[model samples]
Target chain A: MMDLTQPQWVKHVVFHPFEGFEDLRWKKGGTLKYTAVIIVALFFALIAFDRWCGFQFRPLPDAMFSVVPYIMKSVVYFFAWVLGNWAICTLLDGEGTMKNIAIYSSYALIPYIVEVYIQVFLSHILVRAEGVFFSTVYYVGIIWTVLLLFNAIKAVHQYSFTKTVVAIILTIAAMLVILFLAVLFLSLFQKVYVFFYSLYTEILYRLRV
Target chain B: MKNKSRRLLKQCAAAGLVCLLSFSAVSLPVSADEPYDVYNYNYLGEAVPSQAGYLAERSVSGLDLGTTALNAPSDLFKDKDDFFYLVDSGNNRILKIDSDFTQIVQEYKSFKMEDGSETTLKNPKGVFVSPDTGLMYIADNENARALIVNPDGTVFREITKPASTVYDQQLTFLPQKILCDNAGNVYIVLNNTTKGSAMFNADGEFIGYYGANSVAPTAEVIANHFWNAIASEDEKKYRSRSTPTAFDNFDIDTVKGFIYTSTSSGSTDTDIIKKVNPEGYNLFDYMSGYTWGDLFSTWYSGTSYKTKIVDVDIGDDGSINCLDSTTGRVFQYDKEADLLFIMGATGDQVGAFSQGNVTALETKGENCENIYVLDAGKGTVTVFGQTVFGEIVHEATALYNGGYYEEALGPWLEVLKRDGNYRRAYLGISSAYYNMGRYKESMEYAKKADASARYNRAFERYRSQWLREHLTQLLIGIVLIVIGIRLLKYVIRKQKNKKKHSEPAASGSGT
Candidate 1:
């Protein structure tokens, strides 16, 4: 509906994983702000799970005071995946754009984001012997999220399940290539900067002489 | 001028205080001034400086035997009679020194054989005195034989290399170390055999090799096994094969008769240390994958220096002392393989050993009051006497291992006071509190010790007790939360309905 709020739309899309993205697409799709907020919440959920989980269930060997790794895993990895999937889907004549890929993918991640907080809450109350329930909850959340992710990708790209799977594999390969290029760019930039700075220093030395 | 003088005095006092604080910080880790670096690996496998467990007393070399010094004593053993046996390999003799190191009780050089002929030992590397038979087992390295000599320097029996086809006829029998199990079965470590120690029965007839080290399951080894599985029989015969490193030295727990072996093939860390049973199976179960020696190797100019245990000695109190050849350090572990102390380092000082090698390790007295290390390069034995901290740690460890956890609480607390970084003390305290029915306190200490299993056990009981005490409150709290949420939902719906009625078109278009 036109009156559907952002959180309510996300909730509706989550419950209806199969045809959720189709309905969202019919309703002008999603915005970049919503995707960013979802990703930030995902980051926080992961941080809370690691930092506040009970000692019996491993609250990090040493409690991590820094959230840099969690931020990279959640926000940065999500963006990378979205960019990679978009690039692959575009070449495959897919209907999904970069924005739509990010939004749909983030919607799939709601299950995991919810599961982490619940597990974190239960970890403090439950003993290690009763971890079977905790583990079951985690597995259910992860499987549901993965199922949602597959369905979302399929619907957004308007492809068969097999084609969607192939696209995902290609997307992973694309992500690796992008990462390799990123490192290569960074190192080359450092070398160029060093070369220019050395030339400037030589010029200054000549002027001083 | 008088006020200025007072301010200057105050500045001087503050400056002196800062200096004092900085000096205290600098000297915090080193609790004592010693010749060598004494350290122990923490639970995270990082080496931290610790209070000395043993202080190197006097270096003994034939203390009261006048001009006759013990040259390159290869092995040191404390027999059941409390007498010390020193294998003077450089001198080509065995010296039976009294327990007090007061004088050389006896020396064995020229041995009268059963055939009424006399022979002298040539560079004997190992000696073990049996209390029951009153016989001495000596591994005469250069002579290529093991000798069973009587107390009066008479050769009771001589064991030469076996003529069995199982043992390669091409290789010479160069015995490096020898020992006898309670059944009078002799196990000799050959210098050139990876098949394991050559075993001989009571009558000195070769039985077979016993307790060989297994090859590490490395990637290359796994791949080799995979290929060997599919290889044809003819091809398998000519393929290069992987073999296990030879265990260099071993010791037996006189009480349990379990043979504990140490492999000096330093880089091949797998099976570097093992405690074997009578069935020839390695039974060391405590922290099975735990690295026994130094966690990190030091990189020199070209190569990394790793701790390769050349010798092992089982103490009377169930501790295992290992001697490293490269660093000349002694690593001592408790019965549970918890590192208790790390002593000795490479230096030319009296207490320090040479970097080239430290060949022997032995613990003495009823409670292991003194530890003796034979430095082959230095040619002197450095006696390490138990310090106060060590005595407390030993007592606490014994009581803890004996299941007298509650009694060990006091000593563990004392250890924590002396060194807060001692994780074992936290574990002991946690267990003590656990046995005393203080589960909450136990959980607190377990967290400090990083013992998740112990924390879980304690938390289980604590959680049950908590649930029982708060069941009624919990139910009420859940009911209240449900009602509160429902009420909030209704209030929000009412507000939304009012807003819809006020401006229906605007709300629908924007949302």
Candidate 2:
């Protein structure tokens, strides 16, 4: 609505699921500030799910707990999807920009992030036998987030239903390729750095001798 | 200051004395001279270093029992009278030793038959003193006969190869191990038979097979089964049928009469160890998914050594002690199939055994005080004495399994104070605390035990109690938070309205 504020728009889009992304695209851009908050919340949500969930529902960490994997799963993986989706959509004549894609993706992730925190809390209260309620709530959150994401991609790119599915599949493939290349790039850089460092050490040793 | 220091020194001496008294109070019958590197699998299936439950007290030969030196002893059995019947295969006789490891009670070398003929045992592989008939069931190995003889060298019944249609006519009845049940039914482990032990009725009649191992449902087996169902006669002829592994040795429970069998076949995973009831069904059907022997294999001398359980002996406390021929380790588990201790490994030392050989095992005393393992490679029986940690574990396990949780707590805690790596101690303590309604303490131990069911049982109670106590405060906190957010929103909106109204004139010159 023209009278609505930025924060109100967030609530409006979430409650109005199907038409939310469409309305936001027609009216104005989605808020980047809210998207940033959601991304950070995603990281915290993953950490809390792994570390703070009740002992009954979650496995005790087998080794020292590390935040690096959570960061890789949450933020890095999310950004990769954003980049991959944007790049694929460009070639497919999709109209969504990279920024818009990032915003909508983060907005769709809201349900999953909130669900993780709720599940963590519920785990403490429910016994092992009463895990049905916990799992039902968890799957509901996951399904809601996935549906929202599908809708967001469709609405943002102005695509039909089948076209959206195709685009989503291509985006996943692109994400994997991008991830592999990035790892390769990083490891190659590390090797090059090590090589120069060793050369330096060898020169120092020869000079000393 | 000098007076206070003097008092502190006196108090320290008293504390030291108290510590010394407690240490002596819990001193073990087994000394610190353990001859083997003992280990037990934890909850994670990792072999963690553990306190030796059985120390190698001493290794002795047949000469130690006032008999000739034993040669390649194959089987060892302790009867109700606390006498050991050692099957000296090399010596071709059965030597009955007294309870104290001191002297030979009787040497059964020859038996006067009912037909007025004197027959001597030739390479007897097994000897069982039947509690029901009070007779010696000797497996005359090389002679291909089972002799039911009295303890005084008088033979009662001699069983030879049966001429029955059910039995293969070409197969020789190489009776390797023999045992007679309460009803006088004799079950004999044949040297070459995959169809299970050859069962004989009280009248010495050839009965049907009993307790045959089922073929493991591996991927290939399942695939073959699927194909065979829809296969033609020609296709079926081409398909290979899976054969079940034969059990090599078995031990009957003294009290329950349940026969526990062990197969030395290391390739197949199923039916490695079993507890069969009188009805011919495995009592361990519920634990079929569990791996009874060492889950991991080791490498020695360029050959992969996997644990192949050659013999199984049920101890007095209903504990199952399995002897692994490849690793030469005794894997002892409680009645509930929970692994308690792993003792001995293959080496040239006094306690260690030589790998890749047949071994015999027997436990002596009420609580399995001494474990005797007859290593054929060295031709000696290594006697292992129970340690203090083992006593505590046994006491705790008995109480815990008996549902006496409160009483088990003390022993389990004492076990923890000795070996913190003992995973069962954590589970035992957790269960005890759970039964006592100490939910918080139960959760702490449950987490350490890596137990989800027990942890959840405790967490549910802890959460409810906390929620009940803080319900009103939680409500108040929620209400305050909602009110504060509403108030903050109202203030912000009002300030924005003022700015919007005032900025209308300056909107044309916006920055």
Candidate 3:
């Protein structure tokens, strides 16, 4: 018998040709895929703005979508959704056709749309005076939670109802584990961030001719 | 050697810096109340009793619970491993039911003696499964002996003791109603016609007998009258009672290592339920008069709430619910965080209780999502699903508003087990695990999350960043230490050179 423990390069190549292809397809999904891409771009944009300009948005931004920015946002969102969908498809099926890929993407987008509506509604009701831009932090939460639930349900359907219930249970459990890690990681980040910032500043000072 | 030292110092400084950055990146649940929620329950009205109490209508058609020829099934138990066991009392056998009560899938005849001869059993009154080993015991009414069945269906031994009493010529004495603690010690409750019950350990060693023909404690001396008020099935109102007699039942609190027997005595106006520890300790006494007027044939069941001493189930945060068998009322004990959520009393046809008697109760699953109720009279087991296990997450979010890292850890871990690749819980679990003193496990789960999303640049970015931060901390710390040391050495050498030059000049002047 083949040594099951050893890594079989030949077998892996033969078995997983489609794996890399799926990732490529996700990256190259046309204009329609721009929604996911735009979402991801907007996410990063928000985070970057928060870090650099300290211009953190909260509540719901009252500004309506302009043609160019809206298109840009759609592209970012398309990439983001593609990334999420690809992550799921690749993880579950290893490889999926673009047609199948779109179908799955739509399934996930249902919850995404719901989450967006929820954030908009909440922003209007709860933090309306603050303007929609101020509620970015809260909106991020709605997006994350709704996506998690939808993904879990989709996962269950792919696996089984039993698996879905079990998945839901395990998701709750994973929360506890992540909480612990976040604490540890957060504390480490604080000390390192300050130290690095100081070190970079000190080097700049000492290196002055 | 100096270069090596410098490298080591830089590594140390880098390590320290990387550690600091990652530490500040994530939020943790550090609040004291980060564990669980506490709610208080108040007294709701009485539980209604069905005139034609719960009967197996679907099976064997029209078999009434009250007047059915078949004996009332007894000994409802869920093994520690969550396997369900029920002693089909009239069948002279034990039925191992699945958690969902899907079928009477497996049956074990416990009445056989060691010799393979069928031991005569009038009734198998009580049953106990060893939590440690799953060994089963049945109290046979006809045989008048407690028979132990090996885990593999063979009769291990029939425990025969002098305390084993047969009912006076009528097969009245229930042979062995047994309860087992975690240590496999068994406490059998034998109903003696002359004396009430004789308690025994697993070794057939008799402990004591209490409350004979006239010695049974009166109902007035107990603590609360939750088991007092009797209600009709429609739950319209309470019925008045002249006198009531209390029946005793036994159960083992495996977690607490206590064997408890609930006892009650009845007077014309008062009804009481007293739960005594196996050591003949009257721990809690229910002596109050009934809130609702009692009926004549009110059957009461006394079970420890999730093995707690209090006749109620308490969440990790101290929420309490006391189940009153008589009134069918589940009282919310805490008024402040009053969560008197009424359930099982839902007026659904299939799920409704024919009688108000809830014989056994247990809180199962990670968050106690389901409550199991065994009504022997009903011949049915009903599960009440909590629509709000998700409520814990919501409430947890509210109290610990910001990323509740500590509180989130418990739920996140559960989520990971449910769905291994779930990222949100994975991210939550990974960070929580690290903070919760489980580093190695955190790595495994985090790696799973990362692996599941390998093609995603965001995950890769975070994962790589984490690794880079780790390595940089090591490298930078070493570099810093090395530079500091070299600077110190150069200064020292310079000072020595200056001293030597000054001394030489002094000598030349003397010459």
Candidate 4:
């Protein structure tokens, strides 16, 4: 049998969510490098979905490309959820480590990445009238990803279903708090920089006098 | 660093001078070489160089006709006899000029009432001549009344504020423009009424308001509704109330008797142009998805400036000419509301308006050969006569709009010969070919025009034709492929059985 502790075991875990994640936890199969690669791939897939989708599905034909928001949405959001869940898990006496949570969460995103690439390819072939078919596939992919995520969290943390639900809600709340602080930090930095720059300008004026 | 800064300043000055020179060059009046610069958007919505449908023939000021200078002429009306009526609002008089605009036929400053008393107009803003009765109707704006007078200057009727309980008594009755139908039912555009124009009977009796503008549902309106649902009565009292926009000007379609109204405000996007039926419902409401005016402002970035339609004129051929005061351009639409042409601009040149509002627009001649635009600021009426290129386009458009697709094909092709970038010509030619049962050619033209809907229709027909032509060959090929696949499978199965038997026998012998 193929070794369950290999990095390639993530594929088996994603396909067989109930059994595969339980085996991954027992075998210590998940790896941080694989998860980081998956996150980067998902980001590229998202950019491709936006730029190369059919005109019928592309809402903003004249939309400009901005990479900063994409990075925030994919990479920063992934880390936020992992860290948030890790903090909540510690209080709840969950068994998962931070690395385990990151690997499991990234593995759960496999379905979404595959779905987006498929959508990008199908968009070129299908017209507006056949949009229902494309949307059904898209929605199924998202639901499958969500189910995988639930199973991953449950198996990695070794928590009951109810505890997993509460843990997810707390993690979402933590994400919001983290986002608020990030915005606050940016604004405070701006104000401080402005204040110091004005002081420098005033000192230069006095020296010139 | 100091030398570099000085160089930068010199470069900036040079650039500014170049900009000023280019602007002045554009502002210079039309010379013989460059008669007029005209353009129109093609099918792809890209502006392309095209012929000016109309050339500025001459500007007729009241002074040129030996009459008092037209002071802020707010309106112009063309009677059935082709006589021009200028509402000299600032002068408080109506100057009637002949079709040639050279001679003043008559000037009516006051009318004789039934009591033999003289009732003079005060800042009259609008004048209309009834084709049915051959009488004149003047909107006495300052006096807040409309006077119906005979051709001989005798007051037939004077309509003042309606005394009905339905009429809001608090609102002032300032009539700015007036028009009459063949049935003699009068419509008066009031200055301050958001409820729409006030209608009156032939005998000067008050009727209810007609065709009020509807408010556009913006985000603020939705938010206000949400707040109002939960707000206390005392809190609601302090909240601002939403009101509909008012119609600025209107004209009657003599043939269909439909009233066309234009609102000139830039703030509201809803009901900028409306065609009102006699039942007081806007016929243009059916066109909910279409936008009237410039899709995007050419001057402003990331902001859409709605067309401020100040005046609308319906031609004999069922074309609607909307005069946009903001851009000082006339957007002409056919009966189906397809834009046919856009002319004029805001500038100091002869073909443009100089800080002057395009107060009124009128079309003359059997085919609407002449277009007259009155500039209130310049106190001049600039006449535009159709060019040869314009004539061809109008001829083609008239035929196409009239549902003569086959007949319009020749003229549309002729238009393409003159200007290959004309998108309308491509669409027209494609439609003509489609109706002529030439789907392939139609698809080519539709593709050129970037009209996907038309291209899809043509493609459907073309695909069916191709299928029909190759149906027999396709059926034969399918049958042959199926037979070949079955034979190959049988042969492969036989070969596999033989190989299995041979392998088993060889293994037994080896053992």
lDDT of 4 by residue, B124-216 (tens): 988899989998999999998999999999999999999998899999898999999889999999988898889898888888888899878
TM-score for all models, in order of appearance: 0.86, 0.90, 0.36, 0.71
Tens-digit lDDT string for candidate 1 (B68-98)? 7668778888899888888989999888888
Q: Give the number of the best model, judged by DockQ.
A: 1
In model 3, what is the error at residue B140, expressed in angstroms?
A: 1.9
lDDT by residue for model 3 (B157-276), tens: 666555443323443445646665665555556554335465455666655554222333445433223334444445423533332242346555455554444433332222122334
Chain B TM-score of every predicted model: 0.89, 0.86, 0.47, 0.87
Ranked by TM-score from best down, the candidates are: 2, 1, 4, 3
lDDT of 4 by residue, A26-46 (tens): 778888988989999888988
Q: Which digits, one per residue and each the tens of the lDDT, describe model 2 over residues B1-511?
A: 9999999999999999999999987663233465565677778888777787878878888778777788888999999988988888998888888887667888888899998899998888888989876898989988999999986678889999999999999999889999988888999999788888999998999997888888988999899888999999999999988788899999999788889999999778778888998777787887633568799887869988888999999998899999999878898988888898888878887778988664799998767888999998888888888889988898898899888998999999999998888998999999898888788999999999898888888888888878988999999999999999999999999998898898877645532
The TM-score, computed over Cα atoms with residue i paired to residue i, of candidate 1 is 0.86
Report the Cα RMSD per candidate.
4.7, 6.7, 30.8, 8.4
- Which window of ten consecutive residues has the lowest lDDT sum in model 3 chain A? A1-10
Clashing residue pairs in candidate 1, if any?
none
TM-score of chain A of each: 0.87, 0.96, 0.33, 0.93
Q: Can you give the lDDT of residue A162 in candidate 4?
A: 98
Model 3 lDDT vs. the true structure? 0.46
i-RMS for every candidate (Å) is 2.2, 4.1, 25.7, 10.0
Ranking by DockQ: 1, 2, 4, 3
Runs of candidate 2 with Cα error greater than 4 angstroms are: B1-32, B225-239, B464-511
